[model samples]
Target: MADGPTINTIAERAGVSIASVSRVLNGLPTRQETVRKVMAAADELGYVRNAVARSLKSRRTHQVAFAMADVGNPAYLAMLREIQPVLKAAGYRLVLHSTDAVAADEIDVLHSLGERYVDGLIMSPLRVTEAHLRMLATARAPVVIIGSVPEGTRVDNVRADSRTGVRLAVDHLYALGRRRIAMINGPLDTVPGAARGAAYREALHDLGLPYDESLVQIGDFYRPEGARAVAALLDRVPDVDALMCANDLIALGALDVLRAAGKRVPEDVAVVGMDDTDLAAASWPSLTSVSLGSAERGKAAAELLLERLRGDAGEPRVVTVPPRLAVRASTAGPDYDRRQSGYDGEGGGK
Candidate 1:
């Protein structure tokens, strides 16, 4: 055929029924003899299946979309590392969307579900608005949300316990005699920022430490903003003994300011960050941070979406991954081997 080989050509060459050729080409289970014959014929004919035609017939694009607040964020990058392989193995191509933590951008991504370009979606939104909830409730495709949603939201959800994560980091620093602990956090408008900001206060109160207003500085969750916040906090509370950074990026910024100020890590001041990302280990003193299981959350989201795509009609599920403290030289001092990785309290390496 001038248009190139098709399944019909393969069927004729293999002397098999068109149905057998279709099944073999679509990766469906078929008799070994039939599969071998179909494969050989298709190889000989240089036949290639048309993905668009296949999708139209099967009503599945075999593509999965992942929408996140920030692709460059190492925490989200960790999740991507896990999500890509899982989707790849399942024969689904991955489509990425970076929302930049903007509510409107996130809502647009949710609305795009009606396009049918991707079979399902996994979204991690920093701010979940009323519009977001409404769209999620009526999303056209199977959806897996990677952040906190109100109770009874009808979608598969994988959440990080940022509240507990902050507590773990705060408790760890408290145990190490960090009395003047300050929290450098993102804006309180976002979900993670709100959870972590409140958790830091709760942690300090539970430990009988006074919650000083000057000790809390809010900024965007990025290195430059984090550095600015830390610098501002130091100007106000120069004697702040410990810093609880909302994320690794913020913690790295804290390290930079501290180094420039001639303050020794875990000596003059101890620093702890959340989201024990790759940058944590790569930082100069090796950050002591909280592990909220970014990779695990991504994998769980992918699996949950896959289940939904497989026609699972059960109640929407929610998965919550626990947090662990990853102690390192940033808090444990120079005597602690920098080469040795930190561990979760339950004996798992970070």
Candidate 2:
């Protein structure tokens, strides 16, 4: 086996002392001539810096931890897609930890922040309780939250406007002349679920449509739970013409139930989902979804963390990403007109 070249070998080849080679490798300020010799010798010998030893000396790992509620969620995957590139460009490595949406696991992750394994942390805690607040209050390293933390808390936060997201879904249903729009939402105890539930009722009231308790079903934000919720909602309101799902997964489950019941999409019943995840595009008829800017939010959180690591030390900032509506085959029928009606040049002619 070929042995790797060591710093001593590079120092010998460059005609420099071992200390000078070490300084160059550690990114310490060195004379220009010495740095040039070290670089030339390193390139010739194919010398790679010992990162572990370097980190030990600098007391900085240049690694950041990303803790999420559930890595299986497509929205989290989208966030990862955005976060990975930004962190890489900023010279930081990413370490991912899945908490399985449990409060205990989240708290455990928060406690791990004191270990100093990572330079900073970006977390999306499912439920922010008093324990979570305490952890953030005295975090050793910088922390950037990906979801809503308490107001006036001294931590950078990147949040989604799910209230506006729900309004968009309901307004689209109302525009389609569907009044009995049922909601298949997740458990209301969670942050997103609670916000969406309140928004759904507010949107209904705004549209002059009565908020029917019987038409709302609470699920656990899983496929099976979403299917069960859809079944229950259908049983309670058989005349429901539209379904506004809490997230794309729930929307996919609603589609499954509707398909099993032999109901056509956007014809007999229109469906809308949130998150605009890949599942929405792969559905049978393709689901129309609201984009809660998961990718953007992740990028923003990463940027905030990087800024903090760079000693920005700015005041805690909250970034609210706007949601967009994506209309697709599931909400727009196959023969739906794509063009807007206006002057076609035959106007008022004899």
Candidate 3:
């Protein structure tokens, strides 16, 4: 095996000082003669730049961290799928951190910015606490928060308006003439959970439908818990004509229990989920969903962090990805009252 070439070897071959060779190799402005000599020397020795040495000099790891609540959630995975490619294309490696929706764990991720292991970070905390605000105020590296932050918070932020998303789902249900609409939501303390809950009631009022307590079910954002919550909601509100779920997972769970109870989707109760994950289209009755632009948010967040890393000294920016309703078999089937609707089943365009 042959030994690899080094800067010192190039300096020796080029008959130049190490400093001159370093400046020329690092692309610092130098005399044309020095560039010619260095290029000739590098070509002869087949020299390749050392990334570790370059990073040490430039203080850039070319890596980015993305922290989310869950690794397996389809919504976060959609973001991950988009984020991975965008970072990769920009010559940055992605470091994944899952906080499991724990506030302390999320805070730990926020504090880890001091270590400076990566060039930047993109995080979606379930709940942004006072500690989060403190850490973000003095983050060691640039951060692109993928959730809501306070106004004037100096960080690149991308947030989803789940309230608008929930309203879209409810409006679609109302357009289909499904007045007895129910909601299956996650815990209300979380940002998305609370926004979705409030939006459902507001939507009901807008549609002139009474908001019934029996029609709302509280559950964690997972299959088992969603199923349990839907089962209970069904037991209490057996005549529910439609459902607006906080996320696709809960809506899928609603399908499971509704099928067991012998209610046909869209025919008996049209179901709508939020996040518009891939699972939405794959369900038995393809689930109608609210597209919160997960992919767009991820791509935008990566771009923002990369811009910051590139020495853009402007104040932090914010990108709000709009929501759209995606109608499918679950809400646009034979049972729907087409005569009374404004929109067809195919949700809105991208």
Give TM-scores for every candidate, taking all chains together and pairing residue i with residue i: 0.81, 0.80, 0.79
Better by TM-score, candidate 3 or 1: 1
Q: How high is the lDDT of residue 47 in model 3?
A: 62
Q: Write the per-residue lDDT of candidate 1 for residues 1-350, one digit (tens) a residue.
A: 89878778889999999998887666554554675687668657765335423433466657788999888999999999999898889898898888888899888877866545578999999888889999998998899999999887888999999999998888898898889999999989898999999999999999999999999999889999999999999998899999999999999999999999999998999999989999998888888999999999999999999899889989999999999998989999875643365544455666
- lDDT per residue for candidate 3 within 16-67, as digits (tens), equals 9889877666555555467568766866776634532343345665678899
Winner on lDDT (2 vs 3) = 2
Candidate 2 ranges beyond 4 A from true positions: 1-58, 336-350
Best by the TM-score measure: 1
Ranking by TM-score: 1, 2, 3
Counting clashing residue pairs in each candidate, in order, gives 0, 0, 0
Q: Model 2: per-residue lDDT, tens digit, 1-350?
A: 06877778889999999998887676555664676687778767765344423433466657788999889999999999999999999888898989888988888777756545577899997678898899899998899998887788899999999999999999999998888899889988888898999999999999999989998999978778899899888887888899999999999899999999999888888999999999887777788999999999999999999999998977999999999999887788743322222324456322
Quick one: RMSD of model 3? Answer: 10.7
Of the pair 1 and 3, which is ahead by lDDT?
A: 1
* Top candidate, metric lDDT: 1
Give candidates' CA RMSD values in order: 9.6, 10.0, 10.7
